[model samples]
Target chain A: MNIYNKVYFVLLFITLISYLGGFGKKPRYVRMVILLMILWFFTSAVAIYLVKYGGLTNNLFVFHISTPLEYVILSMLFRDVIVNKAIKRIILLSVPFFVALSVLFSVFIQPVDTNNSNIIIIESVILVFISLFFLREILLLQQVTVLHRFPMFWICVGILFYYTGNLVIEGMLNYMIRQSMELARRTYRFGYIFKYLLFILFIIGAFCSKSPRLLTKKEQ
Target chain B: MIISVTVVLLILLFFIVSFLFIYKNRQVRHRAEMESVKEKYNQEILKTQLEIREQTMKNISEEIHDNVGQVLSLVVLSLSAIELNDTTKAAAKIESTTKLVEKVVSDLRNLSKTLDADNVANVGLVAIIKFELELLEKTGVYRTLFRLSGTEKKLNGSKEIVLYRIIQESLNNIIKHAKATMIKISLDFSDTQLQVEITDDGKGFDAGDSGEKNMHRSGAGIKNMKKRANLIGGSLAVKSVPSMGTTVSMIIPFSPAG
Candidate 1:
């Protein structure tokens, strides 16, 4: 790590200490902090792995599978207390979300020929699901206070972009019906870039959580 | 271009992650400070109230010790001469002294009861207000009527204490200055708001025209009532109509307030 990267770790180390402190004392609240600390650990681990191992190609396995698995775990964590029922419904809809994610990895199975019709269908279905989820979250729970809404919003956008980009990747690499690298793939690269932005937003927004008291207490 | 885009993306990601870490820590610090402030505020209010109650009780205690105790002692000393040879006059004097002592004892008991509250369980807002009504009735100065409408649930200790103090202070103001006939106290609670209205058929004052120096001479008991209301995220308003009496209204609204 460089100087700035080293500085980030120092902040990470302090967060780790706070997280450790959380186990012992019960303030009015500390769950949000503990959740952030876990995210930091994973994030720092990713940075370290990138520095140590080199290339997305070398570790495509974890790079692909882990994110969808993380979302599934999150869906469970925010299970019932999520006031926004649509978020839960979207999480269920993401059954296809992870399946489409797995399809992207399966496409790598035929790495020599990336143009496959099944990959296009899977990616398209995911994009549709993501757009629907985003619209529902925005419309239904825009004002509802909850623990998961912020992170869920960004996750919706990220999935949308990830699916859209991967769809284009499948079309270009697998389909040779027409091939012009610069002209055909502009939107695809843009989508991939946008997905990264959404991922960063998701991680940061998770820090804005409050405790879940949705069904247990009547909100006035 | 890819290298530049990649570099920028990595930099942005780093900053967002860094900000998230700092923000989380900042929240912890802010929450800790808020709790201490709340606790400290609770302590300060408790201390002030203790001082005031202690001062009032001490004054009453001293009055009883000096005046009532001395009278009773004199009666006891006079009655000790039971063997006074002049049977008729001596017996009569003894009987008078005994009655004097009994009167003093009753007055002493009233002094203790007059200060308020038998115990912690009895001093809540509802209980204290009911006591004020009974005391007003005994005075025959003005009949005090009380109407309470609420479950009295979710009234935490801090809220209860502050409210009880406010009502006590306001009623004290009415009895002392507002030469009124009847005082009506109503404490109404709803989901969104809690309201207390104390109205009297006494000589009222102009709400706007504050005779501050005069009020200072008499002690700003009304100002203290207002301060108590303000402390609990509420307001106190006193309205008067010359010979028509005065009404003091206190309103406290719970959060997500409208």
Candidate 2:
């Protein structure tokens, strides 16, 4: 819609390509983790664009897909953590809590005291659940040995770096607290730039690691 | 109205792109994984084939060294014992060459006898091994010994050939390189395993360095033995300490039908 948004979208698209390119002979689960992260960023950007620019996108299904998608991705990435009976029960209990939280945040919670209270109330329900799922996914990843294994460790590092880039775009959406508007804008630029750098790092790390030899998976 | 139509179109396009990317990427990755696994399997099959070929060669060598070699010595002895006058001394010289020709004949026989497919089904394993050792013992150079413990039973021909080849190769190693006097061969059937041990008091080489030092490619012997063992679903090990002695053990799982 604007020059700044155009630049942001371009940066985001580049990051998406880099993420797609990470799929060398990496195992299925590891590849899934990266894919989910990319989806999160991509969809988040789309959601932000929809909210800022008036689009006739009024259907509930448009944004509702994110919640279910996030839930599935989070479950897969942290199956080890969520697989436990107690933990699954807890997650099940958290579903309603997330629904409530999303509604509350989208409406009552102030991001620099927003002017449009009605719009906030509606989107907050979806945002709360998606954020919860994403956070749990990250937490589950912590339990998985992805960070410790040879090739995966590097991939994991790259993901973390790429996620840092998302923070830049996220900080600008004004959905969350921002100490300074100018600082938020600057952080957005820094984060996007950092994300691009991480994408490059992922390639370098993938090539250098001996995972292909160890797993005997050929990278095509 | 235009804006609403655009938004709906964008949402549908989003699903199409997501499905296309996920499906295309999955296809490529799956193909790659399958190819890698296929490559590894091929290498293993090739290695197994090489081992089988080597073992076949060793069996031929043993038949030559034990059976043919003995027959050649007898021919030489008979030639040496013949009385020849000066006039026939030249003929005696000609007679000696006959033994040399017999050597070639016997070498050919060695090749044929070892590869004999009927050895598996005909005669059985015990008789074949007994026959091989009896031939070697007739040499009188080394008193070769055979001792068996545990229940006696007929084994699958492939298993027999493998065990026989292993025994044949270890003895060949002792006969060719290990300059030892007494060679003891024993078979023990215990713990669902058929264990064959051969010990020689020959000028034993250090086994720690045997693998590294014996770079002199006499591998037609040891290589064949290992390959035969592998084919028979067994493992072979050789232990040699310098100057003391050398021991070769072959373990073939027999019970529960290994």
Candidate 3:
């Protein structure tokens, strides 16, 4: 693994540790995020091992399988946090539709062997929209007096930054690769910075979480 | 290419920083707004408490003058007429005077118990309101009816006081202006809310005169009633029609404490 991959794994490790420290206290949606992070850690490890040691030239197919799963997990997280009933129902209904679209794009258009830029771009767009929508809702709510202390607010911010960066980087990946593989590799390495940012924000979110029991009592 | 990539990253960072700044700014503004609301609510509560005290004192003054004073004056006349030589007659006079004295004591006791601000919490809102209606009935000028439905629930003491004052203000308006012979007050308690309706049969004014101009022309009683209701997270509505009388309705949500 390169130095960037090593550093990425370290950040992921720190995020997981932070999440574990607050595992019992964190709300259900936050626990789901911990699960997502764990799944991501394992999938990333496996994908890297396949590329470096399993005699595989490319591990883009791993992402093809993981992308829809990641979307489902993140969508579920949003569904829980968002208060609007109709928006919640739409988010619920869109999950299967999103998965089907991802499958179709993988099988017919992009193919699993190539970098799944199309799926990543679509995923990025949908997630960025949802994140922005969540931020808007939180702003309107005005319930949380201290927004920084709110775990979901930080998570939403993290999602916004990560997905927005992903949208731009992945949108250019295929074109960059076709023009010059060296340039694509350089650009892809830059995308790791957002991953680092996502993990750091996740750590902050984990630490910011108040125990659900305490929250319930405070509300009462 | 490197500079373009740097610019994109810089823009992204700037967007995030701006969002944080905006969010923090909005949060500060929200906190300030909430503090102002709380301050206004506290002031209203203080004002309501003072109003209740003032109303209680006024009721006591009126009772002493109209009822107790008249009864005591009659007792004084009865005692002064008793003669030593007419023993049997004097005994009868003494017996009636003793009875009158007992009644005066009872009336004073009841008045003290009901009119004291502290007893509002002790007697509960319904009993206090029922007592008020009973006093109106005793006047003989107006027939007052108090009907209560649903299970009675106790609320926070301050909230109860504010509610009582709102009801008192409504009744005061009726007594001063309604010229209605019959007054009806109904309290309906549901799981979620307590609804109070006060209806009077008298010469009513134009309900449509409730515009801003009319509100200023009429008086501050209705506006004050509405403000008191809102202070306790409740609502007040006044409906009046010329020759059809006026009805004041107030609804208060049951708090978790209730």
Best of the candidates, DockQ: 3
Candidate 1: RMSD to truth: 12.7
Residue-wise lDDT of candidate 2 within A1-220, one digit each (tens)? 5564566556555544554564457555446556655665666667666666846354233344454455455444433323356656655555565556544554566322343223323333333443344334433333322222334334444444344334434534554334776765565555544444444445444444434332222332
The DockQ values of the predictions, listed in order, are 0.05, 0.02, 0.43
lDDT of 1 by residue, B17-105 (tens): 55445545554565577678778768856954674476457647775787688887888778886667899989898788978878887
Off by over 4 Å in 3: A22-25, A49-58, A82-90, A133-150, A208-220, B1-29, B117-119, B209-219
Worst 10 residues of 2 chain B by lDDT: B210-219
The whole-model lDDT of each prediction reads: 0.58, 0.56, 0.84
Report the error of model 2 at residue B120, Å: 3.0
TM-score of 2: 0.34
Q: Tell me the spans in candidate 1 whose CA falls farther than 4 Å from its real position.
A: A1-181, A193-220, B1-5, B32-36, B58-83, B86-106, B114-122, B133-142, B150-154, B191-193, B209-224, B253-258
CA lDDT for candidate 3: 0.84
lDDT of 2 by residue, B77-118 (tens): 767766666648757766776867677696776466545533
Tens-place lDDT digits, model 3, residues A1-220: 8898899889988887877773246666777787888888988999999988999998889999999999999999999989889989988998999899999999999899988888889889989989989999877766665566778877888889889989989999889999999999988988887887788778877777464212232331
Give the better candidate number (2 or 3) by DockQ: 3
CAPRI class of candidate 3: acceptable
Q: Which stretches of candidate 2 lie over 4 Å from their true place?
A: A1-220, B1-118, B152-155, B208-220, B254-257
lDDT of each residue in B1-258, candidate 3, tens digit only: 467557756876787678778877886786688678778877877888788888888888888898789889989999999997999999999999999998899889867965664457888989888888888898899998889999998878878988988888888988898899999999999999999999999898885654555455557888888888887889888877889998888899997864
| Candidate 1 per-residue C-alpha lDDT over A1-220 given as tens digits, one digit per residue, 9 for 90 to 100 | 6544465555555544543442454322134334544664675578468658864434333434444444444444333324566766766776666666565655565331233345345545655454555444444432333423344444444445445555655555434336566644553444445444544544444443422233222321
Tell me the deviation in Å of residue A74 in model 2.
Answer: 21
